[model samples]
Target: MITAEGLTKRFADKTAVDDVSFTVQPGRVTGFLGPNGAGKSTTMRMIVGLDRPTAGRTTVNGAEYGRHRAPLTEVGVLLDAKAVHTGRTARSHLRAMAATHGIPNSRVDEVIDITGIGSVAGKRAGKFSLGMGQRLGIAAALLGDPHTLILDEPVNGLDPEGVRWVRQFVRHAASEGRTVLLSSHLMSEMAQTADHVIVLGRGKVLADADLGDLVRAWTTLGVRVRSPRAAELAAAIAGPAVEIVTTSPETLDVVGVPAARIGDLAAERGIPIHELTPTTGSLEDAYLALTGESVEYHSKEIA
Candidate 1:
């Protein structure tokens, strides 16, 4: 498990992370999310001891990451896939990292195969593609078979197949009771992979809860109804507690009422309903709503 209490970081004139606190439990995949400049990267760096926290503390298990006797065996980290030496082959790179902690060559081969980088293990790191580099980075992280895994944008440059592989890999790791903390900009994938979520905005903790609870709290459920007499049906159900929006000439988007009730109302009004579909709030919807005010860079919409 990973624990942070009042974690803070300041770079000269500006504070990048501000008194953040959250606990990542084991046997589950926890997603880390935020907009640009929200201190997500900075917070991950602090967790792995890449940067010192100005105040408070964070622990990988029960102590600072650096204090572990064999850090690699205790926690596996993948902050940057491009941090490897340009001159070394993928195999050589993994071997070097393993050597530091006395990890045997046999284990290095295991990770290479596990990450599906064996086909290019002999290739130079500098010549590898973005996807291959990410694979190599993941192989290195798994070299020690650590109890905890921290991955930052593991699918940044991956193809559709690679993305699916990562999703399944993290889920499997969590199932085996390993603590996994993952950061990603892909909300759809995160929604499928994470059991819990922790959102950060402007260096502060914005939300920390189960995935379902967070989505329900931040977004509203809606139902879509299609009929030729959409306007008439909408008017019949219009009230202070209900909201209806005309999406198309024959479709209405409704809120504050269930699909079953909407169907019954349409039937009672003698409206010929062609379609009725209920839409629940997604992780993307919750993310946008929660971080709407915390975005540091805003792009003007194009005409």
Candidate 2:
């Protein structure tokens, strides 16, 4: 598990990370999400001791990451896939990292196969594609078989297949009781992979909760109803607190009412209902709603 308490970082005139606190529990995949310049990268750097926190503390497992006897065995981190030496081969890079912690050549070979980079293991890092570089970085992280994994944008340059592989890999790791903290801009994939999420904005903790609860809290619950008597159904459900939007001649999008209630109302009125589907909010919806004001860079809509 990873724990941070009042973690803060300042770079000269600006605060890169404000007082932030969150726990990444074991046996579950926790997603780290934020917009650009939200201090997510800075926070991750502080967690692994790449940058010293100006205040508070962060611990991997039970102590500071640097204090671990074998840091690699305790935590595996991949903040930047392109941090490898450009002159070295993929295999050589992994071999060097493993050698630092006395990890054997056999384990290095295993990670190469595990990350599906065996074909490119002998190729120079400089010549590898973006996807290949990411694979090599992941292989190095898994070299020590650590108890905790911290990955930032692991799927940044991956293809569809590689993206799916990462989703499954993190889920499998968590199932085995390993702590996994993942950062990604892909909300759809994060929604499918993470059990919980910690959101940061402007270097401060904006929200932290289970993924389902976060979505429900930040977005409206609605039910999509399709019926020939859509207008009548909308009128029936209309109230001071309820909202009904007409999407089509035969369909209505409803809020402040449950699907069962809508179905019951339709049945009572003898209205023919073709479809009554409950539509819940998604992670993307929640993220946007929660971080709307926290966004540092805004792009105007194009005509």
Candidate 3:
């Protein structure tokens, strides 16, 4: 298990990650989600001992990664695929990382095959495509066969096949009771890949819970009712708190009110409803609803 306790990091005048706390347990894929510059990369760097935190700490299996005798054997991380030496071949890069902990070449080959990078194992790292580079990085992470895997944007530049492969690999790792913490900005992908989600905005965690619970808790349910007297019904449930947007004639997007109340109000007013259906409320809308003004960079178009 990977646990971060009150983890904080300050860069001179700016705070990157502030008093963040979350637990990543084994037997499930815990998704790390946030928009760009939300301190996700900084947090991942701190987890792997790449960045020094200003205060607080993160521990893997009750031990700081730096304090562990065999760091590579404890946790495998793929922060940046291009961090590898361009001059070396993919197989050579894995071999070098393996040599750090005296891991055998046989193990290196094992991971290369496991990540399906065996075909390009002998190709130079410089000539590999973005997808191939990501595969190479995954192979390097699996070289030690660590119990915990921290992958930052694992499918950033992957093809469709590579995306599917990474998803399956993540599930397989967790099925073996190994810890997997995958960070990505893609919400739909996170919805499908994760058992739970840890959402961050700016530098703080806004929501941390299961995918369904987070959606239900943060996302407002919007129901569109097409009634003969739409305006009359709207006035019945009208309030400053309730957000109402009319996208079409005789249709209204109502928020901050339950569907049952809407129905009751319409029935009382003798408004005959023809269409009442669930309108899609986006994940971004849910995030904004929960965090309010905490979201970074609200553009004119987005806001």
Off by over 4 Å in 3: 224-282, 298-303
- The collision pairs in model 2 are none
Candidate-wise lDDT, in order:
0.94, 0.95, 0.87
Tell me the tens digit of each residue's lDDT in model 1 across 1-303.
Answer: 999999999999899999999999999999999999999999999999999999989999899999999999999999999999989999999999999999999999999999999989998999999999999999989999999999999998999999999999999999999999999999999999999999999999999999999999999999999999988998987889998889899999999889999889988878999999987789999999999999999999999
How does model 3 fare in lDDT? 0.87
Candidate 3: worst-modelled 10 consecutive residues by lDDT? 279-288
How many clashes in each candidate? 0, 0, 0
- Candidate 2's residue-wise lDDT over 32-146, tens digit each? 9999999999999999999999998999999998899999999999999999999999989988998899999999999999999988899899998999899998998898999
lDDT of 1: 0.94
Question: Residues 1-303, candidate 3, lDDT per residue (tens digit)?
Answer: 999999999999999999999999999999987776788899989988999989999999789999998888889899999999999999898889889899999999899888888888998999999999999988888877899999999998899899999999999999999999999877677777899888887889988898778778777778888876888888888998898887777888888777888888878888888887876565556655766666576668765
Error of 2 at 36 (Å): 0.8
Error of 3 at 48 (Å): 1.4
